[model samples]
Target: MSRRASGPTEGAVELRGIVKRFPGVLANDDVDFSVARGEVHALLGENGAGKTTLMSILSGAYRPDAGTVSVGGAAMSFKSPKQAIEAGIGMVHQHFRLVQPLSVAENVLLGAPSSFRLAGNATEDRVAELAEAYGIRVNPSAKIWQLSVGEQQRVEILKALFREARVLILDEPTAVLTPQEATHLFSIMRKIASEGRAVIFISHKLDEVMAVADRVTVLRAGRRVATLAIGDSDKSELAKLMVGREVMFRVARGDHEPGAPHLTVDGLAATGDLGLPALRDVTLEVRAGEILGVAGVAGNGQRELTEVIAGLRPATSGTVAIGDRDLSASAPAERIAAGLGYVPEDRLGTGLIPSLGCIDNVMLKRTDEF
Candidate 1:
C-alpha cells in the first residue's frame, strides 16, 4: 500500500491510509485519495474493485478500520451520513433516494432541519433559484414520479447543494441518463467544481473520466493502483492499471441469418404508475437466435412494456405472442411456463429475496415441483 504525502493544506477533501474489511474480504487496503478545492476527481475501477466501499467510508456510511478523513483541511470523524453532510460531505447514490410522491422542492428539503419552518412557495422559489444558478433544468414543483430520470438526478444534486455540501460525491451519476442528458450533467459538474467545491465522480466509464475529470484514481482488487492527471494518462493505460493487463476494445463476430420471430408485440399500450400514457402504440418483434435491444432514455415506458409483456402489468390494448401462443392475458407463472423468462430491473427486491440463499431463490420459480 503506497502512501501519498499529506499536509494540513493538502486538498479540500483527503483520505489517508483508508482500510476497511468485510467478512472475509479486505474491501479497501490502505487507499489514499484527495481532491483539491475546485477540482473534479474521478474514481475508476472494475466491478468489485472496492471503489464504492472506499467512497462509502468517506460518506460516513461505513467506518474505516484504519484511516483519517479530512475536509477543508480539518480532520473529521463522521459517524453517520448526517454527520458527513454537516461536515460538508454529501453523496448522491446511483439508486436515487427521492420520494416518488413528493415534489422536487419537497424531496430536497425532506430531511432538512428547517423544513418545518420554511413556507411551501418559499422553498420552491429557493430551489428554482438554485437550479437556475447551476443550470440544472428541473421544475421544483414537479413530482418525482412525473420527472424523467435525468430530472430526478438533478433533484438529488439540488438536495446536496441545498445542504451546503462543499464536497459532493456522485456514484455512477450517468448510469440512467441519455447521451444528451449526460453531456448536460458533465456541464453541471464542471460548474460546481468551478465554484470552488470538490466533486468526486465515481464511474466505470473511462471515456467519461477522460472527458470530465481533472485527475483520476484507479483501484484494483481493493488496492490503489495509480492516480494520474487527465493529460498524463489515456484510456488504454487506465484500463491496464485497473485490470493488471492490456484490454481488447474490439471483437470480431461472424454474421449469421436470423430465424423466424420468436416473440412479438403488436400495438402495445400501457399506463405508468401515475395513470398517464406510458407506452403508446409500441410494437416490435424479436427473432429467434437474435438480440433485440429496447433502447431509450429511462422512464420512457420500457419498464411498463416489459411488465405488460410478462403479464405483470395489463395493457390497455395489445397482443403479446410467445411462439404461437397469445400470453398477453396470462399470469406471470403462465408466461414462465410458456418459455418466457423475465428478469426484472429490481433484482434484489423483485427478482429474488436477499436473505435467501441462491438455491432457495432459484426454487422460488419452481415451487410446483415441491
Candidate 2:
C-alpha cells in the first residue's frame, strides 16, 4: 500500500494507497503522497483532479475508506477538522473564512480555548507585532470588513502563524494577489520553512509553483501521476503534468470596436440585513465590444450593484435598462435572456457545485442560454 519517492526528507508525512468515495463518483483511488518537514510542496491538478479531495482528507475534513496516514512514522486517524487542527495541521482555503464584523486580531484568534482572548490595547499591540514580524502587515484593530483583499490574506496567514502551525496549507493563495504581494508572500514562505515547518501550497499558477516549491506533486483524475523536484520541473512540463499532455494558454477575441450600451444603471441602492445600504446609488453601463473593468478594493458596491443589475437583488430606487427594456422589474433569468451572460465573481459557495463535473457545468451554461 506504500508508494515511495526516490529519497526521504525529514519531518515526513506519508499517505499510502488512499481511497475515498462519494455516492456516484470515486473521488480518490489508491492515492499516495509524501511531504518532508521544512519543505514547501506544491500540489498541482485540474479543477476536479482530487487535489482538494486529498487535502481535505489530510486536513481531517474527510476520511479515507481504506488507507493509512502517518506523521513522523506514527500512524494517525482524524475524524474531524478540529482533531486535525489539534494535530498541527492548518489549512487556509482559497476563499478565507474570516468574520467580517470582527477585527483582524479577533478573526485570527476566533477558535481555540477561552484563555487566549485579549481586550483593550494588548490584543491590538500583539496582533500588529506578530503581523509585522512575519512580513505580513495589517491593522489589528481594523474590522475585517474594511481590509483589502491582500490585507485580509495577510491576516489569514497570521492566523496560522499565530497558532505556531508546524504544517501550513494554503490553497491558491496568490490567485488575487498583485505580483509584488505574491513575491513578498514567497519570501515569507521561505522564512517559515527555514523555521522547520512544512508548507503545502496548492496552486494553478505554474510559475509560482516552480518559483516557491521545493518539490511538486502532480495529481490527475484523483491519482498521483508524478513527483518531481523543483530543479527538474519547468512550467510547460508542470502544466502538462496537471492537465495531461498539453494546453494552449490563450483566449480568443475579436477587434476592439466599441458599441452602444447593452445595459445601463444609475442611482441604484440596496440595504443589507442590518438595514444599512450596501450599494449607494451606483451608476454604470456596459457597451458592446467593450470590456468594463470595475476596479475596487473588494466589498465595495461592486457585488451589490451587479446583483441589482442581474435582477438577483432588488434596488431601492434606480433605473436598470437592458437595451431600453427597463429591467428593474425583471427577474434574474429574464436578464440572461436579454443577452446578459453573467459569469459571476464568486466561484465557490455562491457559484460552482462541488459535486458536478466539467461537462455538466458546461451543460448548465448552454441550457440556461437556450
Candidate 3:
C-alpha cells in the first residue's frame, strides 16, 4: 500500500467548535471537522443542513459567528477568498464562475500572471500540457458555453491547479453532472488526492459519497452527527446518520399518468443580453409534478430558456404558453398565475432573498400577498 493509501495526508486542516448563525436559525453550531493531507474527505448532508455554511467559513466566504480555522497547525484568520488562495486553498462552487464566451485557459488564468500581459498562447499551451497530465481534457480555445457541464467542471478544477491550491474544496460538484461526467470527476479527484493534495467534497448523494470518500461525515440540522469510514459502512448506515432514521428514496408509480402540460414554450427564439441570438427556435413542454432535466452544456440555451419562461428575460420572438394561456407578452406575475414553477440557474441573483429565512424564502410570493 502507498503512504497516501493509509491515514490522513499531511497538510491537515482543523475546525474547532465553529458556530454560525443567521437570524432565527443556527446554521452551524459548534461544528468540528478536520481533513488530513491528501485525504478525499466527504461532507454529507441534506439540503440546508449547514454543510455549505461550514465550508464557506473555511473558504473565507463567510465569517463564523465563533470558531477557529487552523491549517497545518498554523493559526490564521481569512478575511476573503484571496487570503485563502494565498494560503493554497481553493473552492469550486456548483454554479461555475467561468465566463461562457471565454476560453478554458483564459478562465483558469483570469486573474493569474498579469492582467496587463497579453496572456499569449504560451499559457494555453502550458494549460494543455497540465490538463493532459491530470487526465482533465478541456479545449483551451473552446468557448465555455460550448462545453458540457462535466467539461466545464474540469475547467473549474484546472483553475484551482493554476492557482496552486493544495487544499481543494468542491461544493456539490456532481449536482449538475451526468453519470459519465461524474465518473470522470471522481477519477480526477482520486488522481489529485494520490498526488498528496487534500480534497474536501460536499455532496448530498450518499452513493457518490460512499463510492469516493475515505471518511464520510454526516451533518444534520447544522450539527455533525457521525463520521464513519467508507469501508465499514453501507448506504443504509450513512442514510441513517444523515437523517437520524431510515428514509425511502424510491417511490413506485401506478402507471404512465403524466397530466396535461403545465408549461409550454413553442418555437422560442431570443436575443441574448449582449444583443446576440441566444435561443434557436426551440420548442418544449413541461408537465406538473414532473422534473424536467434539461441536459446541455453551460450557457447554451438552457439558462436563456428558463429565464424567458420565468418572465425574467424577454424573448425576441416565440410564444411561451402556460396551460392554455399564451404568456409571451405577459409579465412574471401573469406567468405565475399560469402555473409556472421556475427555478432559475442563478438562484442567488434571481430566485431567493438573501435576508429571508428558508421557509420564508419559499413562501415569499404567496405568503406576502395573501
Best by TM-score: 1
Clashes of each: 0, 0, 2
Better of 1 and 2 by lDDT: 1
Predicted candidate 3 versus true structure: per-residue lDDT over 1-370, tens digit per residue = 1224466646578998899999888999899998887788999998889988998898888999898998878886999887777777889997789999898888888865343233469778877977998889898888898997788888999988887788899999987777777888898888888777888999989889878888888899999998777887988888888888887778775666678898788998987877889898899888867767788745577888888888888888789888888889998877776666777766787789977889889787676376
Quality of model 2 by C-alpha lDDT: 0.81
Q: What is the alpha-carbon RMSD of candidate 2 to the true structure?
A: 5.6
- What C-alpha lDDT values do all the predictions have? 0.88, 0.81, 0.83
Q: In model 2, what lDDT does residue 280 have?
A: 80
TM-score of each prediction: 0.82, 0.77, 0.77
Q: In candidate 2, how many Å is residue 128 off? A: 5.2
Arrange candidates by lDDT, descending: 1, 3, 2
**Predicted candidate 1 versus true structure: per-residue lDDT over 1-68, tens digit per residue:** 11122311338888999999998789899999988877788999998899899989988999999999
Alpha carbon lDDT at 90, candidate 3:
83
What tens digits encode model 2's per-residue C-alpha lDDT throughout 25-81? Answer: 788889999888878898888887888888889889999988988766778899997
